[model samples]
Target chain A: MASPPTPLRAPEHQVAGHQAAEGRLGPLVDGAGLFFKPLQGDGRGDDEVSFYTLLSSLPSSSLPSSSFFPSFHGTRLLPASDGSGPHPHLALEDLVAEFSNPAIVDIKIGSRTWYPQASEDYIRKCFEKDQRTTSASLGFRISGIQIRDGSGAWKPDRGEIRRFSPRDVRIALRRFVSSDPRSDPDRALAAAVYGGADGVLAKLGELKRWFEEQTLFHFNSVSVLVVYERDAGATLGKGKVKVKLVDFAHVVEGKGVIDHNFLGGLCSLIRFISDVLTGLDENCI
Target chain B: MASPPTPLRAPEHQVAGHQAAEGRLGPLVDGAGLFFKPLQGDGRGDDEVSFYTLLSSLPSSSLPSSSFFPSFHGTRLLPASDGSGPHPHLALEDLVAEFSNPAIVDIKIGSRTWYPQASEDYIRKCFEKDQRTTSASLGFRISGIQIRDGSGAWKPDRGEIRRFSPRDVRIALRRFVSSDPRSDPDRALAAAVYGGADGVLAKLGELKRWFEEQTLFHFNSVSVLVVYERDAGATLGKGKVKVKLVDFAHVVEGKGVIDHNFLGGLCSLIRFISDVLTGLDENCI
Candidate 1:
C-alpha cells in the first residue's frame, strides 16, 4: 500500500546468468547480486595494506597482505569452504575468473560506476591459471542500491541500453527532492536524491522547475549530497566513478541485513569501513 | 520489522527523474502511469522519428485516458484553450537534433527496452507542434534499459556490449537453480525462479537458467509462466557471462510487462513471458 507511484527510471533486466560450478561456487538463481567496493591500487606493502577478511584452506592460514581487488588489478577470493550445511563455502579462483573484464580499459575516466560480471573460466584461466578464489571476504560502501533484472526480461544479445540523457537524471533529482526541496541547492545535491514524495500535476511543476537551474554533488565521509536549482538542465547529469574496497563480498559476508552467502551471498557495505581500518589488502591477504 | 533477513528486492525508488518533466506530462500522470500507450511501431512510418515533451509548456490538459502514454508522428492538432496551464513554446526542426541524437530510431522488438530523455523545449515543442499527444497522450514500451554506466564504470566513451560466453551462461544458470534443495529440481526450477518465493540468489539462478535453456513464455490474461530446461545449468557460480542489463532502473520500466496502447503500465512479467515465448520461437527470437 505504500507504493506511491515510483518516479525513478527502472533498472535494465535483460541479463542471462550462468550456472554456478558445483563444489566450487554454489547454485545461482536467476538473479544473484554481489557488491564490491572499488579499491585504489596504491603501492602499499602487504602488511601495511588494509582490506576485509581472509579465508583459509584452514581458518588459521595467513592472509596475503595486499588488496585482492584493486580498481585495476582485482583478486577473486572464495569462501573458506562450500557444500557443508547451513553455511556453505565459496571458492576463490572462481571469483576472479568470473569477474574478469576485457573492456574496462576503454571506459571514460569518471563518468559513472562500472559494475560488470565476474569473468568466464576460460577468460579467468587466461589471466590466472589457478582461477580460484582465495580465502577472505571484505566489504565496501556503495551507492548502497542495486537494481537487478531479477525477473530476466532484458538480455544483452537482443537488448540494448536505450538512452541516458540529462532529463532522466533531472526528473530523478526532482522527484527525489519533492518532499523537501533543498533551501540551499549546493548542500544537498547528491544526498537530496535519496528523499522525496511527489503529488500529482502540481508536484510536476516543482520537478520541472529544477531544470531551470544548476546542480552540484558532494561525496564525503558521510552520504553524498546533490543539490540543484530550478530550470538548470544544462549541467545536472555527468560525472566519473569507480568500485572501491567496501564492495568486496568474499571479505565481508553480510549486506544491508542479509548474510546468506549460501545462495547469493551479499557484498557487505561495512566491508569498506573494515578494510580501511584493518589494512587487510588481498595481495598479502 | 518485516524486513526479511534476506528481504526481497523491492524497487520503490526512482533514481534519475525528469522531476520537472512530470509537470510537462502532468495531466497524463494520474494515480496510474502515463495516460497513453505507445503502439508497437509497424515500421510503416519514418525510418527514424523521436518525440520530446517539456515540463514548462505542457498544455496542462486533464487526461481522459487512464494510464496510457501516447505516440505521435508528423502532425499537430492543438490543445484545448481551457487546459490548466499553457505556454508559447520554441520550435525545433527535429526532436532528435534538440536531443542531439542523429542516429536514434524508434521501434519495439525482441527482449529490449529504452529510456530516452527529452528537453523541456523539445517536449514543449512536441506538445505545441504535434496534436497527437495534445489530443491524447501516447506511450512507449520499454525496449531496453540504459545504464548511465554499466560498462566498467559508466564510461560513455567506451561503448561496448558486455558479453557473456556460452560457458558463463551455464555457470549463471546452474547457480540459479541451487536455491531450493527441497523442491523438485525441474518443477522447483520452474517455480523457484518462475514461481514461488525464494531469495535473490535463487532467483538469479532462475534467470540464468531461463536464458541458457531459452525458455518460452505465455500470458493467459493473468500471470506469466516460463518453462524450459535444455541448457539449464546444473549448479551456480561457474560459466563466463558479462554483466547484462546491470542498471536495474530499466527493468522497473521494461521487465515483466506488456501494454495496450495508451493503457495499463508495468504489467506483470513481460520479460519472463518473453523468455518462455522465445523458447517456442522458431529462431529463438
Candidate 2:
C-alpha cells in the first residue's frame, strides 16, 4: 500500500510545547492515556478524535487480555470542551502499580508519519530482511516513561521519555538478555509478547489477524509495552510478564491507504520481532 | 491439628429447606454469587457470616490473576439490606463467557465437618501415602456449581451441582489429557494450576504461603475450580487453562483446628491432583 502524505499539522516543537501547557497536570504524553475521543471540535485534530471513538466502542470483554496495552480505565471530561476551557482526560491503570517488582520496556513499532522518509525506509527494509541468515536491527524504536510504583511513588525507568531506534532496541534487548543468563530471556520475552505457546510466531500472526479484523486505520505508530517483575521466582511464570499495545492517535477506519498500510506495516513489524525472539542464535539479530 | 468437632448446625435437609425459602430469587446456593456476608439475625449462621466478611475484605489486587476462581467483580448490596430484605452479593466475571470454547470443572477439595470418621480416616491415609506408589483416592469430594455465562445467561454444565470424588477427577483429567497428544497434558495442567512454572510442588507451596499470609481462617470446604478453553488451537497454549479457589461459607479468624485442618487437607488434595497430572505412569498414581 502506498503511504499517505503526512497530513498538515503543527511542527513537533510547537505541538509539544502546546501540549505541555495544556496537560500540565497530566502525564508527559498528551492523550496517551486516552481510551475515548473527546467530542468533535474539542481542539484535538479530526484523526485523533475518530480514532478514540472507534477504540472506545470496542467491548472490553471481547478483547483478549494482554499486557501489550494498559487496561484502559474509562474517560472523564474535565470542566472544558462543552464550554470553552473544559477537556476530556483518560485515566489509565498504572502499569508499575500492578507488579511486585516491575521492569517495563516500551518499544514503538511501525513507521511514523512524522519521521523523515529515509528513517521510515530504513525501518521497512529491516522488517523485510531475512532472520535465519542475517543479524540485523529489527528497526523498531524504544521509549521510556515514568509510572507510579505500588507505593504510589513515581519512578522513571531507564528508557522512559525518548524513542530508541531499532539499533537501540537490539542493544537494549541484548543487555537485558545478557544481564541474567538464568532468566532464559528470549523465552521470557516471547511468552510476554505472545503468551506461553510453543509456536510464538504463529500466535503472533493470529494476534495480528485480530488487529486487522478491527478495520482500524493506523496513522500514528504503535507502541509495544512489555512489563516483567524482577522477582527471582517470577522469571518463569506465565503471568509475570506482559506485553501490551498502546497509542491510537493516528487510527481511523476505511478502505484507504492508511488502513491498508497500517495492517501491512504492523504485520511486517510483528513478524520481524517474532523472528528475533525465536531464533536461538543471540548474535543472529 | 486435631479435627475440630463439627460446629452444631441444622441438618442438611432443614438447612437446604431454609436456604430455599430465603433465596427465592437467587440461585440454589443462597450466597452462590455473594461477595459480602448477609447481615446477622437474617438467617445465615455465624460461620457463614464471618466467612463472607473475611473474603470481602480481601483486596482484589493482591490476588494473582488466576483462572481457578472466577474473576471478581465488585460487591453490590441490593435493596432491603439497609433495613429491608435485600442482600449483598458478589458479582464475578464468568469464565466460560470469557473464552471461545470454555469448559469448567469445579472440584470441591477439602473435608467437610459432616464427613464420617471412617471417610476422614481414609482421606488421612491417602494423604500419607506416597504419590509415586499409591493409586488410592485422595478421599476428598468435588461438587459442581452453576455460574453465569458470557451471554448473561445461567447455564448448568453436565456436572454442575453434582459432586465428584478423587476417582471422578482422575477420570475426567485423564480424558482431557489423553484427547490431545501434542500438548503434554500433565505440564499444561500444572501451568493452569500454578501459572506455568517448573516444580509444581514448589509453586503450590508458595501459593499456600500466600494463603496463610492473609491471616484469614478457612473453615468452609475449599473448592478448586479449573477452567479450560477447548479451542482446537488452545490444546497447546499455556494460558488456556485456569484454576481457582472458591466457597468461603465457613471461614473464620484466629489459629484454630478448623483452619489448620483446612490447610492440611487442601495441601494433601493438591498433592494428589499434582501427582496425577505430572506422573503420567498411570499405575504410579
Candidate 3:
C-alpha cells in the first residue's frame, strides 16, 4: 500500500487558550481508563471543519493547547490549505496515494485493523491491556487462515478489520436467519466466524433477540463465551442469551459474536449510554 | 443425605445492629448487607460461613452496606446471580430425595457434580450475568449427553448459588482439579459436587497439585473447564471443547457443560492455579 498523506490537526496554541477559559471535569477516562478519539468528517478543502470535529470529540470543557501534539496537527492530521508546521507539506498526489494505501491501515491476522500498523509487539500489548481501549486504538482482528481458494495457491485469509463507527458495529451483529447475501451477513458470518456450528449460533441469536424484544428491561440470562481463533490465537468472544423458556432448568441459546457485547443494564446507565451507545471512544479488548 | 440439621444461623437482630458498625462504607441496605454469625469462639456453634465470607470479601470501604448483597461489588455486573438473593434456596437433603435417595451430588456425568434439584433458572442467571460482567461465566455450563446417569436419572445442577468470598469463588472453580480425597465430603462427592468431564474428577488432584506452586499472580492464565448438568432442554453446552478440538470450523455436537475459553491470559491462570492450589471457592460461577 502507498504511504499516507501529511495528516491535519488543530493548532496546539489555539486549543491551550480555550482550556484557560473553561475548566474540564473529572478524569475524562473511566475507572480503568485509557487515552481516547472521534470519527473524522469528509476530508475536503475545509480543514477547519475537520479540525473542529476532532476537537469536539475530545473530553474537555475547554479547547486543548492549540498544539494538539508537540509539532503536528493542522499540517498533518487534516492537512491545512497553507503549509505551516513540520514535514514538507504533502502534495495532492501524496494525499491521494496515502488515502488509497492499505499500508495506511495495517491489518493484523484475524482481520484486525491498525491505523499506522499493528506489529506483533503491538498485538502483545493489547493482550496485556485486557480491555477495549487498546482494541479501539487498533481495529478489529481478522484471522489470517491458510486457505486454498479457487486457485490452488496458498493465501492469507482476506477478511478485513476496519475501524468502524459504533453504528457499524451494531449493524454487523444484527441479522436474518437464512443464507441471504447482503440482507444479513451476521448469520452467514456466524458460520464462517465460528466455523460451522449449526445450532449453537442459531439458538444464541433467537434467544438474545427475544429477551431484547420481550421480557422488557435488561435480560434475565446472558452467556459470553471467549473462544480464541485456533490458528492465529486471536482472542474472540461468543455471547448467548439463555432465557428461562419455561421451568427453572430449561433455557435457549442465542447468537454469537467475535466482538461480543452490549446488553441490558450491564453497566451504570450513565457509563453505558455515554461510552457504549455513543462511539466516543473505540470499544476494544 | 437425610435432612441435615438446618444449619444454624445467627439471630437477625444481633447481626443487623453489628452490620453497619463493621466499617463497611457503601450505601447500607439495613436488611440488605449485614449477616448473622454466632461468634466463632462464643460456643453458640454455627457453620454458616458462606454468607459472611461472601460479605467480608467486598472492598472494605463498601463492606458495611455491601454484605447484604454479597454479590454486588457494583462494578461491571453480568446479568443476575443464580442464588445471591431472592432466588429459592435448596438443601442437600432435598437434592438427595430428588435424586432417588442416592446422594445426588454423587451422580456423575462426564466428570461433574450436579444437584438436579437445583434450579436451571438459577444456573442460567449465573451464566448470563457472568458474561455481562466479565464474560467467563459460561465456564459453568455442563454437557447434555450425560446429564442423566447410566440408567438415565436427572441431576440437580446447583447445590447452592449463594455468593461466595473471592477466596471461596476461586477455590470452587479450582475444586477437585486435584486434591487429596481426605475425608472432606466436598472431595468425595464425585460428580455430585464438581461436574466435569466424567472421569476428569478422578484426575482433579493432579491438575491442581501441579499448578498450585506456580500460580503466583493474575497473569498465570490458568483455568479449569468442568462440565455441568442442565435441564431436559435440547442443550446445556456439553462436550463443546472436545467437539471444537475435532475441527475448529466444525460446530460442537452434544449436550451439557463445556469450556470454550482462550488459554492465553486469565483463562490460563485459572487452570494453572487450580492445578496447583487449594482452599478456593466451591460455587464460583
Index of the highest-lDDT prediction:
2
lDDT of predicted model 2: 0.40
Ranking by TM-score: 2, 3, 1
Best by DockQ: 3
Candidate 2 chain A lDDT trough over 10 residues, lowest sum: A8-17
lDDT of 1 by residue, A137-202 (tens): 111111221111223211112122112122222222232333223222222333322212311111
Q: Tell me the tens digit of each residue's lDDT in model 2 across A142-251.
A: 54432222344223343332344433444455433332423334444443434355233444455555543332343445555656565445544556555566565544
Better of 1 and 2 by lDDT: 2
Question: Native contacts retained by model 1, as a fraction?
Answer: 0.00
lDDT of 1 by residue, B66-169 (tens): 11122222222222122433322112121111111011111121111211233456545543422221111111112112211112211111112113222222
**Which candidate tops TM-score?**
2
Candidate 3 chain B lDDT trough over 10 residues, lowest sum: B241-250
**Which portions of model 2 show Cα errors greater than 4 Å?**
A1-25, A28-42, A45-50, A58-73, A77-87, A114-139, A145-165, A177-195, A198-203, A233-236, A256-258, A279-285, B1-285
Report the lDDT of model 1 for residue A129: 18
Ranking by lDDT: 2, 3, 1
lDDT of 2 at A12: 20
Question: Tens digits of per-residue lDDT for model 3 on B1-285?
Answer: 121123323222211112223332111222323222212222211222332243346455532211112122212111112222221111211111112112111111111111122257754564344433223322222211112333443322232322333233343333422222112324433333334552333344333232122211111111233333322332323321111000011112111111112211122233323332332323222
Model 3 regions lying over 4 Å from their true place? A1-285, B1-166, B173-275, B278-285
Model 1 chain B: worst 10 consecutive residues (lDDT sum)? B215-224
Residue B63, candidate 2: Cα error in Å is 50
Worst 10 residues of 1 chain A by lDDT: A102-111
* Each candidate's DockQ: 0.01, 0.01, 0.02
